[model samples]
Target: MERKEYYAVIFTSKRTDGDNGYGKMAERMEELAGQQPGFIGIESARDANLGITVSYWESLEAIKHWKENSAHQTAQKLGKSSWYEDYFVRICKVERDYGMNE
Candidate 1:
């Protein structure tokens, strides 16, 4: 099933310096996000300094719920304190989308 409208949360960030458990935390967060209500999909990429992740949801409420998740809150604090130098989150409405699979 596919929805004609949805929401996307785009997360862009720059790393502070080292691993400092960032890798494990990121993986864990992704895993946890997959279990959230209204979660549609996620795409992510990262290099040495920059990282960008986009998560899709069915509604703003679903996105909000994920943002307020307990473990996610802790990860946010850890990100600010130890992992990320800077970050930005953008929410966009997806009116239409299409893709082809080979």
Candidate 2:
């Protein structure tokens, strides 16, 4: 069967200096996101100061809800104030995808 269209939230970031609780918060955020409705999956990678996390969602409304989540909001504030030097978030509609395992 063909997969339906979905949304991917691509979050790219540059770290400030040290962990300072970032690792714990990131783990918590991932756990919370998995519990949310319409969450598909997530992938993340980091090297030195740069990081990229791509979270899949069923729709735009789902993404909006995730953004409004209180814990996630707190994390965002913390990212700006403490952990991240800079970041970018891009939402893309995925109409088709191909992978080796599939």
Candidate 3:
């Protein structure tokens, strides 16, 4: 499919310690986000104590909805209280992009 203007939410974080249900929560969040409106796609990578997840959206409103989701709110609270040691979120507009064809 041809792509157009969109938004990317970049979430970068350093984990606290053990699993503590983080792995399961992360998987659940991904699954839930996929079912939300205007969700485009998501990409993630983790190395040792650090992780990066980029979720694509059709608009900022859609992003806001995802942020306000009750389940997501729970995850956010857990992230702050137990999961993440530190984190940063960056939202950017994708004006243009190009990549090799598969």
TM-scores of the candidates are: 0.93, 0.96, 0.96
| Ranked candidates, highest TM-score first | 2, 3, 1
Which residue pairs show backbone clashes in model 1?
none
lDDT of 1 at 80: 92
For candidate 3, write residues 1-102 as lDDT tens digits: 458999999999999989999999999999999999999999999999789999999999999999999999999999999999999999999998777872
Model 2 lDDT tens row, 2-58: 579999999999999988999999999999999999999999999997899999999
Q: On residues 9-97, what C-alpha lDDT tens digit does candidate 1 reach at each position?
A: 99999998778998899899999999999999899999887899999999999999999999999999999999888999999999988
Tell me how many residue pairs clash in candidate 1.
0
Candidate 2 colliding pairs, count: 0
| Predicted structure 2, TM vs. truth | 0.96
| RMSD list, candidates in order | 1.6, 1.0, 1.1
